[model samples]
Target: MPLALVDCDSFYASCERLFRPDLRKKPIVVLSNNDGCVIARSKEAKAMGIKMGVPWFQIKKAYLANGGHVFSSNFALYGDMSARVMNILECMFLQAYEVYSIDEAFLDLDTLDKNFNLYKFGCHVKRCY
Candidate 1:
């Protein structure tokens, strides 16, 4: 069976928005250490021309003018959320997986029953989140 990779997009930014439903769909950027650079950014933020590693000061004016949300990196909160996600994946895949990163994993599809439909399984996983 083929290996499947599961990863979260804009992880840090997504984590920040999880508790702030109001910020969903808005431009959100998660700053790097000391608020020095743009680390993770939401889809809206990317569309607004905010690139990763760009110094935050360079885009401060435009970002704020467009009602964008800025947040410092919160590794503690992100770590907890990631753990929760990994736990869910572990249970779903019967622990036949490896945590590739805080936001990514490699699941062993060979462990699943031969009758299992991968597409349906993917949709089910998406719905779970």
Candidate 2:
């Protein structure tokens, strides 16, 4: 089966960037419920030793010291964004595609006659996203 897996880098951060221009180049974190832990981190945040599920209290000092912005999970916004992404994909491809998560999807390319260009296809998916 020909398949394509599209994974967004720093998905939460990218989602935040979509709405807030100021966050585009900054260190950002998406926290879990009650702002208890870090569920997602931008590349910058990852480099600073802020691990996923690290208690918010333990990381608060370092996060502030490092100028990281913490945000509560905005599922509403993320969900809307995800729907748009899926709609784009549905319009672009003829074969069946399944959204695995907000940041991941699988596409079937079995019908394409030529050997599928996985990398190029991934690039297209990335751009669509």
Candidate 3:
């Protein structure tokens, strides 16, 4: 069985940006509970050298000075968003799938047509949700 490992890249950061278009191009980081450490970061944030599990206070000043945005963990919003993505995959691929993590899923492609173009299907699947 051909398995496709589908993971949401920068999931927390991406979820935070879903409703805020202004953040689309900015470096973004999501702090852990009580705002102590960094948990997630956008691609731009990663490029800016913001690392996971780092103490937020250590980087707050420099990160803010360089136009970075920080957010507290929003579990409700993240969970709801994750479910929607999973639903899309389940509906399209049926029973041959597994939710590997909150932001990653594994889909079995054996149910698909052998002649199907996996590359194009993968692109379409990504755009689905």
Q: Which one is best on lDDT?
A: 3
lDDT of 2 by residue, 12-119 (tens): 778987877887668899998899888999998988888988988998987888788888999888888788878877776654788899878887877555775767
TM-score of 3: 0.93
Q: How many residue pairs clash (N, CA or C atoms closer than 3 angstroms) in each of the candidate models, in the order given?
A: 0, 0, 0
After TM-score superposition, the amount by which residue 74's alpha carbon in candidate 1 deviates from its true location, in angstroms, is 0.6
lDDT of each: 0.91, 0.82, 0.92
Best by TM-score: 3
- The regions of model 2 sitting more than 4 angstroms off are 113-129
Cα TM-score of candidate 2: 0.83
lDDT comparison, 1 vs 3, better candidate: 3
Model 1 residue pairs with clashes: none
| Global CA lDDT computed for model 2 | 0.82
Q: RMSD of model 3, in Å?
A: 1.5
Q: How far is 39's C-alpha from truth in model 2 (Å)?
A: 0.7
Each candidate structure's TM-score, on Cα atoms with residue i matched to residue i, is 0.92, 0.83, 0.93
* Model 3 agreement with the true structure over 1-129: per-residue lDDT tens digits: 778888998999999998888888799999999999999999999999999999999999999999999999999999999999899889978898999999999999898877879889778857864
